[model samples]
Target chain A: MKIKQISIFLQNKKGRLYDVCAVLGKNNINIRALNVAETEAFGVLRIVVNKPDEAVKALGEANFVANITDVVAVEVPDRPGGLAEILKVLADEDVNVEYMYGFVEKATDEALMVFRFDNPDKATEILKKHNIKIASEKEIKEL
Target chain B: MIWNEKFECMPAGELKQLQGERLKKLLPYIYNNCKAYKDKLDKAGIKPDAIRSIDDIKKLPFTTKVDMRDNYPYGLFCTDQKNVVEIHVSSGTTGNPTLVGYTRDDIKLWSEVMARSIACAGAEPSDTIQIAYGYGLFTGGLGFHYGALEMGLRIIPVSAGQTSRQLKIMQDFAPKILGCTPSYALYMAEEAREMGIDPKKGNWKIGIFGAEPWSEQMRTEIEQTWNMLATDVYGLSEIIGPGVAQECPNKIGLHIYSDVFYPEIINPNTGEPVKEGEDGELVITTLTKQAIPFIRYRTRDIVSINHEKCKCGRTSPRISKIRGRTDDMIIVRGINVFPSQIEHVLLGIEGTEPYYQIVVDRQKHQLDEVEVLVEVNSKMFSDEVKQLEHLRAKIKKEIESVLSIGVKVTLVEPKTIERSMGKAKRVIDKRQM
Candidate 1:
């Protein structure tokens, strides 16, 4: 299953992260899971939000350069080697992982991980073949 | 295509002899008319008769922008106020602007050289020339106008701004030649596309761009965008505007009108002449200016000179496209910017540190953009995102107020910018031009 993720271009300056949150908050859009990837001059603020289209619209209205990206979410056992086992499968299948982030479900012994793969469709097929549980948009939005 | 074959192709020896005679006459004119020159020559214990040959030009004192500013409006004019027909003032960044007066003969000489410059750029009397350089105080507009008129070319003096109107005029008039800064030319191309007109498919065949330093990469971009031959033309108000030198269709270097203007390359720091073909500061002396002829005036522009005959059959010396300015001045979108001006703005703000770097880049749209990377104190860096953005906005506003140029202010971590042992590198120009 594919999840809609928002990637924002932020100059490496003060208040950019807050600005993104303020825009989302004012529009009543909630950020489900977020991560910041940074370089020397700028950073990319990525978020899995409840309403991605709404969040993108709100962020764009606030003058933020935001784009929609497709990512996949998977559920793994909440164990010591949970991520390692899934990563090894993708590596064996020759599917590259650009970046990934995750959060654990509160009531289940399973952790939900989001992945940005080089080939999302192939990665989804490989995970399905390996009987790995793929989380849908409803599951992520509910979280 | 050489406009003045007799003078442009004169033998080196005969040209030097003519220069020597001109210098002999010009020295006496300066010593008698201008008090500042008389005093300087008297203090140096030199007389006008002592200068016998062109080599003796080295013995004369060097004039600078400060000398011109100190004298103000008409102190340096060799002719009487009644004889001076026109005056052009440079847009000085600070204090008083330098004034250049011209008599009727000087205007005729400027038109002659500019006509030659236009010919060098491959424009003929049959082509229609569209001038986009700003008019009034700036020299680019009128200089091209007079020269194109002198060459009997059809003229459309559009001046700068109004992108939509400019494109409409271009499409309607179908002018064959374009004159403006290289950046504006690129900007107009982008606008033309938005207006549903393809610049490459348009009627323009040649573009003469100058008034700012541009790279060969920009030349390629302009050429590819418009599918036309793009050439560089060099000039300054302190000299005789845009006709002092121009790049021929060969695209090698700008041929200096050596008969009217004598060019010398000298070490900016030591003031000693450099070997031919060596890069150094450009010093020019007006050989035929009537109102205010300068003798070995330091142009402050860095370039190398080539004395070899060009493929265009012009024997006059050619100067490489200006590499950069000897001073700290940086040209962004045709506007001069100084790091110290940015520093002044940053120092006034509370959160900013003394350390900052000005990064200049040419965007994909072909216009220049300036970014100021400023280091902030630890407190400011750790502040809430809203506060940090407020600080950036404040700094940008202050800088725009002082420099009159829009800039992107980026707050960097303290000590993030590399420090140097001696002179700090305050500017990073990413534009290849």
Candidate 2:
């Protein structure tokens, strides 16, 4: 299943992240899972949100560079080596994962991982063939 | 220790007469030989006979770097290519480079002036000189080379860089004169200390520094570091290189060889001659150049000329150290860099906004470092760090290729670079000198 994630461009300046959070909170958009990719000059703030489209619109209106990216979400067992086993499958099949972050599903108390893959459709199909439970956009918003 | 006392010590009234005679011949020579000068003069409605003396030089139209670029390769040469013995090209603002040609006699003139410049720095005929100015089209290294040859001084034509070897040669040969850019002279001093050598203990006696502007504070630093008399030498390729004017041991204003290359200072905005000892744009005319002669060429360098007698007894008019430039051009490590050139490179690259800023800084005991800041737009921004880094590298590569110097490319937030009245301010030079 494909998930929509909102990515905000953050310059390495004071109060940039606080400004992003303030804008999101004012718009009543809830962030589900977040990860920051940082370099010396700037950072990319990527978050899975309850309302991806509305969050991106608010960020754009606030003069922040924001866009929606398609990512694959998979459910993992609440155990050690869960992420490693899933990663091994992708590595064996030569499917590249750009980046990944983890969050816990409150309903089933299961671990869920968000992955940005080079080819999201191929990654989704491979995980489906392997009988792994794929989390959908509905599951993201329900959280 | 004046090199040629006959010309260097000539009385002021006599020098002006010789300058007038040279200018009298130069006007008609360029008028008939070079079409660019002829067209410029014809457009100004001034005939060759209108210039009876050097005093009438104010009547001539001013030539600029843009004019030289428009003429390109050989369009400005007064003599035939067969008589041209050498050529040098300096970087222009954009597109075409400024070209200069030297005839055999012009090369001799360069040598004589350079010899005088070296001697003005207090060099004796028996002393050795280590020339570290770059050679080739730059016109710095060979300019000093010819001068050293003319003076019959032992020369170590090291020709810039190779820091450890430069220190080794300085230790081995013990040259009396060190010729290079002032910044490089300081850089060498630092390198020598790093190699466990005392720069002050070296056998260097005189430092002939030019090709870039330096402050008197820098002069004190260099002199103390090397235990040598550091003097300033000034020149541009358009008029003969590196031997136009030089500061004598007296540390007064640099004495201009106005006998051959007549100097004038004018208001940059009004084009009217400024009063004596007042700062303005420097205008030079090639009075005796055979291959390429210029009439009242606007050098864009700001300075003031002193006509009073120097304590050294050289009657040549002395010009104050260069204060600034009339244009948006800067010299970084002896290379001319215009902001327009950087802007041109940025505009050519897709996804980059036309707005940018150049930051030049010089740390103590180091050469200059340039950092170019380009604002990141939504279209160029990416969620991946690698993609953003790739874009920065691309901008860095394109700019370095255009400027021929390495620079650091920094990506900033949109609107981070300050703006005043809706236009982004371009350059921020933080170097103290």
Candidate 3:
């Protein structure tokens, strides 16, 4: 129903992203999908990793401010109107999407999307009622 | 209770008469005793008898910090070296430090004024005063120490640092009064929480903070944190230290012991006296200082003075809390800005800690740019990205409205900015100018 995403607070300085990656890599933590939402001064590095808990601990030990957040992951058909159809469903159901990002699966004609909603539990319930393919924690972990 | 009622509550006319009499005597003393003052007065075409009344003080040559530096160690001392019992030096962050010598009588006078200051802050003689200002050579520690002793209060002369020891004394000694810079007081509050002690529940009832410019918001923060009256004490080492002026419990303004030190506000650039209640550089003349009396000595502290009767019932004129030093005003893109102004704006904003650093840099060797790094609290950090961006924008707009200069506002994590046990450093000017 929900996937674990790690978010890190990064100052807008050179080599900070590399430093975070190095810390996770050294700790044998794998980053699956990542999106860097930034402003002029700082950025929030939202990452879906193999082990969200381990990633948070490793980042904290490296002196990076990080936390674990719950996000909804879904599998969408790799077609032109797939995202538009999902947006229509959310709009009709009155569910709000705070932010969303996705990656295309290399093994099949499918796209994996991560979404942060105003209410994750309600969003999961509404998407399930619409018969959308909701990716579970185990599914995202395997990917 | 007002101390020295005879002088503190002196009527205006009688106070002027006393000042005239003191000025008349001070002119001759400086003319005959101090060679430096004599030379300056002689060059300005003035003699000892030229000062007929207090109003004629304007004709006398003004003294500047440069004069003190030129004289260095003891050239300004009006009395012989043997008569001088003690000395205190300015921190001299810029150029050579100015030296001030005090006679035994001068020290006694300092203690009396400091004791009066303590009384103004609502501290009783029965209360124990814990002084945290640095001891050696610094005026803050010894100044408060002598004053508390003069007031018959038990004093613990624990000067600055060693946070653990400071807390231990606070817990065991149960002092009712705390003395230190405003920044250090805040630092101690934070440290106390870290050590699992609730400062608000402690025995401290009053805090006498001084030696640096702080905003009213900072005052509120310290007061709320320790559940004590955080009163501002005004003095400089060039003057008699922490006893020149003090804010009454009313917190309106700091009452200058004008019977001892005369206060005036003047234009920093033109050196002309400004209208009453107008902000200008503060100038002081020691009416009773014996060892090294200053005549219209330019303090370089920017503030305004109100001669109206205060709610505290003291007729002595009160000076507004220092706005900023004349030299501390940074010129960013042709607009004058004070770090305290930025602090005021930041502290007023919700979800912001009262901690900030202003960094100014020259871009392309021409234009000036300002970047304000503000510390974000847990509430602000927990907000969504849009809300955080809105906060940043709101801060930038507020700063621009007040400073009339655009600035980049960066929301930094808590504890990212350096905290000081003494004066908190607020600005970092990377510009070559």
- Highest DockQ model number: 2
Q: Report how large a share of the reference interface contacts model 2 reproduces.
A: 0.51
Q: For candidate 1, lDDT tens digit of each residue in B45-74? A: 899999999899999999887788688877
* C-alpha TM-scores of all predictions: 0.68, 0.93, 0.60
The sequence of per-residue lDDT tens digits that candidate 2 reaches over residues A27-93 is 9999888899998878989998899889988988887888788998788777898778888888999
The TM-score between candidate 1 and the true structure equals 0.68
Ranking of all candidate structures by their DockQ, best first: 2, 3, 1
Where is the poorest 10-residue window by lDDT in model 2 chain B? Answer: B89-98
Q: By TM-score, highest first, what's the ranking?
A: 2, 1, 3
Model 2 C-alpha lDDT per residue in residues B1-433, reported as the tens digit of each score: 8999988889988988898898888888999998998999999999999988889999999988878888888888888999998998887888666889999999999999999999998999979999999988889999999999999999999998898999999999999999999999999999888889999997879999999999999999999999999999999999998999999999889999988889999999999999999999999998999998888889999999999988998988899999999898989889889898888888888888877999999998898999998988778877778988999999999888777788999888777788989999888999977
Q: Tell me the DockQ of each model, to 2 decimals.
A: 0.02, 0.58, 0.13
Please identify which of the two predictions, 1 or 3, would achieve the higher DockQ against the true structure: 3
- Can you write out model 3's per-residue Cα lDDT over A39-114, one digit (the tens) per residue? 8788888888888888888877776767677889877777999988888899999999999888534224578888
Cα lDDT for residue B13, candidate 3: 93
Off by over 4 Å in 2: A77-81, A104-110, A125-133, B80-82
How many Å off is the CA of A49 in candidate 2?
2.6
Q: How many residue-pair clashes does candidate 1 contain?
A: 2
